[model samples]
Target: MENLNRSMKLSLEFGLSGAVLLPVIYEVYANISTSIGLFLVAAFACFAGVKFSALKFREAFVGITCTIAYSGILGWVCYLFIHPRVVDMLLKRSVYFSLDIRQQLYFLLYCFIILACIYLIWLVRFGLHKAMEKFKSNSEKTGSYIENAFDDGKDDENL
Candidate 1:
């Protein structure tokens, strides 16, 4: 039930998620010098979290979980599909042990997909919440708690 439909909240979530997972991915899977990017993203996440209205901690928790889960899954997939190529690339005794252009692009694509999945998960949650809100609001607006289903214009003097 996060208000992740808002742009600011979504951005904050993305920043925080990226800041957390990018460094981990760099250490675990590939080395891409994410320190500066992590710092910037984390700083923005902090700023946004401070400037915006505070949501329940569950929102942050869920976002972190989503990011971690997505990253973990992506990691395994990459390990299966891309790690072999990277290992082969590195074992070639080239001047640079870094990833090739295609490898770099694949790594970037994986990172982007993880972050995007986090947003997509939260978007689905927000959509469901909005739909329930609309349903509840429609009922509340169209109905009343009063016992009377119909009322005459005249006030009963006999009461």
Candidate 2:
């Protein structure tokens, strides 16, 4: 169906975006400390959420979630395979840090927090949009009432 095709297209786009962006992001963060890099990535996730807001709510939610999953997978691949190979070739040494259990737990906690923040932003945007629509409708009704009142006064003057 058309909707299925559209959803697949969106998913592919998001996946490709993640595949391309995550490595570049890793390169950018390579020189930075890990904590700072994590924060920067979280900020990037928030920006992704904002960008995804352009789509219908359900579509945006699905797309963004897919994007995040793709990014995580790509990031893991880079960390485990590509990065080690590159570092070993260039530096003639292994440059990698295997996170302890606690570190991993912390990382997961941070990821969850980032995801929650992104959804919160989406919810706020949706709420604001609905509120604005309601406000516009109310204003139009008020305008109509004022116009009717003025027309009634005009009829009285004619009499």
Best by lDDT: 2
Q: What's the lDDT for residue 133 in model 2?
A: 90
Please identify model 1 stretches exceeding 4 Å from their true place: 1-17, 31-99, 142-147, 150-159
Candidate 2 residue pairs that clash:
none
- Model 2 misplaced regions, further than 4 Å: 1-14, 19-31, 85-98, 157-159
Report the C-alpha lDDT of model 1 over 1-159, residue by residue, as the tens digit. Answer: 435444435444554455555544553444545555444434433443332323334564454455445544555655565555555665685432456788657656655554444444445555666789899998886676443455543457545
Clashing pairs in 1: none
Q: TM-score, each model?
A: 0.38, 0.69
At residue 140, candidate 2 shows an lDDT of 100
What's the distance in Å from true for residue 71, model 1?
A: 14
